[model samples]
Target: MKTASRWAIHVVPGLNSFAYGRIAIQGDAAHAMTPYNGSGVNQAIEDAYVLGRMLTHPKTTMETVESALKAYDSVRRERAQGVQELSLQLGRLATFTEDLQLQPGADPIAVTAARLEAAGIWVGEGDLEDDVRKAEENFTKFIAKA
Candidate 1:
């Protein structure tokens, strides 16, 4: 008897914004992902890096920590969510039989492989320096206002 494996990716909107009232969640606590593209660990690391930098900066203080967390949240939420969506899309591409069966193509597997390759760009290509700069800029503005 052949059994099918159950694989799923559940996404929650705005999961990276796990800070509130001096409390913040990081790593897997902030966002969860399936091990589709092996991005879960990397994302968690990124989250920790962002949160750690904000909370440990010399300019950050107890009074202004909230602003830093908010800036981290603002920067991380969209990027993390984008990764989640891409992971889901990659899963769909890997198991694209349902849609392909309906409309038989000359090479369904090839098409799926191409789609997967295209989607992998997001997973593999990201500018961490640029992201950090933007987050710092946002945090600076937040601090200035506070």
Candidate 2:
């Protein structure tokens, strides 16, 4: 086996805030993470899609843009933060640590594999359609009361 010379690892903590106003943040601007599970770009794309749907819906208007943005925040913030946290967890599992090395009866390789599989399941399974529908419905209801 070839010996590795050097390895570097970095993990970013999950961010809970991703919304402000019409000036919405997405991508790395919203949640930055190590390139472990490829969640940054995927979440950004999902953000764009959801924002687009919210903005273009017939119920949304200039007067209601703030309401739409609030809807986006309601729908996307928790889910995006979840993905960010999972990415951080995967990053921690990938990097070698003294604790991992010293743990009795622990198989680092197997643990890593299991963590990765769980992350894959989480990142792969999402109901974007349902999220968008809820955003639209909530926004409509929010504005109806205004």
Window of ten residues with lowest summed lDDT in model 2? 94-103
Please report the TM-score between candidate 1 and the true structure.
0.80
- lDDT, residue 136, candidate 2: 86
Write model 2 residue lDDT over 5-89, tens digit each, in one string. Answer: 8777553455555556556777777766667678788888889999899888887788888788878878888887788777767
Model 1 lDDT tens row, 49-127: 8888787877788888988888888878777777877776676677674354535546887777777787777677787
- CA deviation > 4 Å runs, candidate 1: 1-16, 97-106
Residue 16 Cα positional deviation in candidate 1, in Å, after optimal superposition: 7.5
For model 1, the run of ten residues with the poorest summed lDDT: 97-106
Count of steric clashes across candidates, in order:
0, 0
Cα-based lDDT for every prediction: 0.75, 0.77
lDDT of 2 at 42: 88
Q: Which TM-score value belongs to model 2? A: 0.78
